[model samples]
Target: MFSRFLVFLLFSCRSLAFEDTYVIGAGDTIQISVYGEKELSIDSLNINSSGKFEYPYLGELSALNKTPEQLKAEITQGLLGDYIISPKVRVSVVEFRNVYVNGEVKKPGGYEYQPGLTVDKAIALAGGFTDRASRSKVYIAQNGSDDNKNKVKLSEKVLPGDIIVIEQSFF
Candidate 1:
């Protein structure tokens, strides 16, 4: 039993290692830094509706479909190739847009996506399960994708826009 429990724990930790990299999206605020160039540390970069951002030196750059790291690399490459030499860039996400969590939770609303957040944690953040909430029957609707609407059971990690539904327990 001890060995089985240990195996389960290891598997759980490994499965939680999904990439949480921020993909530049509209309404997302990002912080971009250029190593050794204090003047280049720009904050509050909002991706436009066309998924682009404008910097004074870098001009307009695409932010959509690019991770924070990827965006940094692209900026560094662009700057180094055309203007600066050997640029070092770092990108960080200062704000997440939002994620919705509703149904059966005590407070049921939206919450920001933080590191190491699980289904149980999100539910707890919404004031926890109500007396009529069936914890065991918790369901997650990921991205509202109908093709991927299959239910997930015994899973902890829930993604953004995942609607957690707690069924009413029949007595």
Candidate 2:
């Protein structure tokens, strides 16, 4: 039916925009659960500054740039022999990393990153822009890299670890 086709189209478009596979990064908090093993489940584990985490049976595991599903697979594989038989492992991000907002914002600092966050929302979290802030001079440095800095608008989507700078306006 036309209605069914329209519903499918809508869902497909939504999925395209959704970040289904989020990469793990430093400062992110993760939770790992094994279906039947209480001791092996990690309620909450923060990825260290080096983007690595120590697991009981897995020893040191690098989580940087790996998706939660990928990490789950690694853990499941590591525990298959000695730790658990057929472990139904689940890994999820408990908290995302923070994004920094600096310059002309009143309360400029790092704020927790969330999905669908934009420059406008980040500025709001930083107590909005100062009176002298330049609305047209917003810039973003991805992952704190100045080399990647570029001019952006208020509607620009903010990524984790990004640095947003609001220049001072004079005129």
List per-prediction Cα lDDT, in the order shown.
0.71, 0.89
Kindly list the per-residue Cα lDDT of model 2 for residues 97-146, writing each as its tens digit: 99999999999999999878999999999999999999999999998899
Over the stretch 97-158, how does candidate 1's per-residue lDDT look in tens digits?
55566777788888887656688888878888888877678777775453565445635777
Q: How many clashes does the backbone of model 2 have?
A: 0
TM-score for each predicted model, relative to the true structure: 0.75, 0.85
Enumerate residue pairs that collide in model 2.
none
Q: Which candidate is the best by TM-score?
A: 2
The C-alpha RMSD in Å for every predicted model, in order, reads 5.9, 3.5
Q: Pairs clashing in candidate 1?
A: none
Query: Residue 159 in model 2: shift from native, Å?
Result: 1.0
Alpha-carbon lDDT of model 1: 0.71
Q: Which stretches of candidate 2 lie over 4 Å from their true place?
A: 1-19
